[model samples]
Target: MIRARQLKDWLPITKKEIEMRGWNEVDVIIVSGDAYVDHPSYGTAVIGRIIESEGFKVAIIPQPNWKDDLRDFKKFGRPKYFFGVTAGCMDSMVNHYTANKRLRSNDSYTPGGEAGFRPDYATVVYTKILKELYPDVPVLIGGIEASLRRVTHYDYWQDKLLPTILEDAPADLLVYGMGEQPLRDILKAVKSGVPLSEIREVRQVAYMAPHVPESPDWNTVELASHEDCLNDKLKYAANFKIVEVESNKWQANRIIQKVGQRTLVINPPYKIMTEEEMDASFDLPYTRMPHPKYSKRGPIPSYEMIKFSINMHRGCFGGCSFCTISAHQGKFIASRSEQSILKEVDELVAHPEFKGYISDLGGPSANMYRMKGKDESICNRCQAPSCIHPVICSNLDTSHKPLTEIYRKVDAHPGVKKAFVGSGIRYDLLVDDFNKNNQDGNHDEYMEQLVTRHVSGRLKVAPEHTSDATLRVMRKPSFKYFHKFKEKYDKIQEKHSLKQPLIPYFISSHPGCEEADMAHLAAETKDMGFRLEQVQDFTPTPMTVAEVIYYTGVHPYTLQPVKTAKSPEEKQVQNRYFFWYKPEVRNWIRNRLTKLGEKDLANKLVGNTYSHSGNTPKQHKKNKSKRR
Candidate 1:
């Protein structure tokens, strides 16, 4: 079903492509840190397509060389309106380094799965280059890197508190969160002749000015200045509480923070996008493939993974303390109409590479599609960061009927042999012990459908941690609910005579987790006959409660001291518990736990059966090599 595509199908990425379009100058030039993949899953493509859909000439410069003469940036020359800069789908530092700050060998967004294409602090680096080359031209920055760093935050890679990204990048403006609505607003104003620096009324944007703009229409909340935060950690921690609360609200106040002489103004975000607006963004004329320029370099790993997948919705209401989804995507869900989703399904099925298998059809959380508060007025007056945390909201609608119908319809498609839900599901939502809103037995029906049809042999979920103390600090439900959910999942499996296992994800060295907590987590999951394949050592990224706690040694919401493993040795010791089944580390675990007076916990893990031998280690290594 695939056909030869014209060069003009995608947004222009090269000078020749722009020339082919017969445009003398482009209205916008997007400089990105990721290889240009013309898919809705990629932010650069979405923004570029939005610009083109708005009737502006937009071209992209993907992964421009920062070390060279900067010709890649200059290739497009100056855009007629402004230069759009993004550090791509992920933050540059996160993409470049591992949790231990070791350099990563591969970049998923790069062709051939290679690293070293994008520099560290890519947004700042790219913007600096553009500002130096074209000082008179305006530069605008957005994406996860800019959105999460819009306020003063702790940069884990640098191991220090940093000011707003606007100060470092020196861009004219920043459009935070999902940029569709704010981007359109800016485009309209610019087309109407409003200067970039003068358009200060757009929502979901942050910019620096000499003083606060006078706006009587909205209330403003001033955060601790960058200087004050450097002098006092508590002040910095306090600032995060305000930022997170306001970010999740319906009618949020404008946030202003002083950084040196200039004031960083973060306008309140736009209300969650309606169904129509969400559809328009996804319904753009995306070629649904990487630009032809990268065909010789090899496939982009991230693009290939999601090429056939569809994102049914946006945003997450879970608001886990360690996560950035609710921070960057907001707390409310913006779902696409089923018509738009099916339309994409048809397009995906036509791809030559799609062999009747859809990789995934999910969003931030798989089950959150078409979910939101039932009463608008109640949501408008609420300020809580999480909707389903602590307890599900009374006015919120948690019905799974719409999602079940969508799945059934997709399964009925003759082109699709199977549609897998690869995205991690929020298992806590389906547990009757935790969620009281499922009185209509929608939960049972949905679980049956999902377990029977959607699971790809192993269904993935995140219990995060087993310890109640650690789970409380993480703002997650009790692990007891996970046990309940597993029981139900097992029953559903038995009913269908299926053999799909639940893959529960866990974290070590999180903000409130201790060495003993990880020990308990290992033993608990081990009792359930799990080898613990999915696990990670926590990395403190910017704009999350865990990061703030890791830096300040206290909870932002309660200001209570919370213990965190900081030193490399301490973190390594905690992480070892996740792999208790490995014989190589059993002796180490036993010794460390006994030293900490946790011999009982040690017995549960190593079971007093591990002993170090002079030649056993060599024999074990030889056996491992033979298997390989």
Candidate 2:
């Protein structure tokens, strides 16, 4: 392992850095919406490092000034191969705005957590600037914004169905999903004297074509036209079902869709990375620090949060309807070898800033490391979006032994004082009694180890909602599983004589969740003695099942109509339930419940006579009618 001090600095971000590297011109220039951070967690850094590993000269122009004379885009001039543009680690709109459509005051990706570093629709804006400045240079767009908005889909901010982003951004190619493999192929093809226009056969890439030509070798599924989706909501809902299913499959068919006169063909993504490949990607020589240019601007909040953390794996199998991890990272889990993880731990120990405490040793889901299908052939042919939702698939291997062992090994390091799993844990995976077939009776062992060692007074898990109906719509398991897991967790804490808290996360204003449902959730959790602090009003981002339901009024999978809180008043009403314990919201909650003729729930939530001390009366009036 490379010692932290011996690691090379960040990639060239300016002409001086390029000259320092003894290169007059670069082969590829990456324009990003985020401030340049040379950590593996940053997408631009990873892509740049991968290209550099291929012996290609690469440089980044991060969060460039697009409002000026377009000098930033011209600083790097034209690349020998292509100009790679990304809206950074997050979707630009999500980074810029809140769920309530209010402009966010801070961007975590920017240096010093400043706002307005990148413009709205950053991918489109950057690509347009590069194309206009260097029209002859081919531009390839990737990252979350381009990946999620590759095809015609709903745009919640605009409140309409917009066509493929390619229609708006004049780019030659769109590399979607985790882009290491496809990018390597694209680079190889470019090195072989192949034009960008003719490199359409690469996987995980989408390109605009003059016409829809027949492919005799590959099977294709054509989606509803952009015009049809724009004209009809039902057609739009149906199109998302195909897009989602194709995206999750192991061997997906090539998808073709038309937006106006152009035909957009999105090839299937590369298969899940092997253990060696995942290790190699993480093992790349990353300085793991923000660029020195931002030293005077104060530390990046996001970087500080995870500087000492280790990402054990990629992707999620939970496939929660409201989440987009599966949409971009794929449902299959790609984990690093034990050696790779330990090497990173050693590197962290050597860092001058690290104080022997590792912030996180987890990924999308903490306990899903080294977990996958029991049979390779079964997984290859499987089209299920989630391996552990609704019910854990019988073919899935949900053992926690591997993860527990890794934790113990990391803790055994003399240089490390503690290693926490900061990512949200899928509690259902620990319910061995509940999921008998998939588990190996090691649930208690894993739970005890985690609560006794890793947790720092609190462990977070997402139950999402209390209502079974809403959980189904969210593609989450029943709340009963949370109760079961909580029982086990409490038992383990008592055994260890520990006082750790099991913090459950929930979402308000989710699809299929009514105002009454939110009230029920509040009452149920209150009975369990929880004043929820980790709750959010559902944000409808692109390429999520809940977003599709929110925009189209129908579930993509079942064409069944779903009710969503769209209006500001409607969403506010749902959000109020999350704060039922607050004195200010108690009266409003009672009034809304009384109007809905749920007097029993009203009294249960806030006593007939509410108090201002943030506490409900000990004795409450009983209702004549039985509870619904």
- List candidate 2 stretches off by more than 4 Å: 1-8, 610-628
lDDT of each: 0.92, 0.89
Clashing pairs in 2: none
Candidate 2 lDDT by residue in tens digits, 197-313: 789888899999999866665689999999988888898899898888889888789999988888999988889989998887888988888988898998898998889899999
| lDDT over C-alpha atoms for residue 80 of model 2 | 91
Per-candidate TM equals: 0.97, 0.96
At residue 295, candidate 1 shows an lDDT of: 84
Q: Which ten residues in a row have the lowest lDDT in candidate 2?
A: 619-628
Q: How many angstroms is residue 27 displaced in model 2 relative to the true structure, after the best TM-score fit?
A: 0.3
Per-residue lDDT for 179 in model 2?
91
Query: Candidate 1, which ten residues in sequence have the lowest lDDT sum?
Result: 609-618
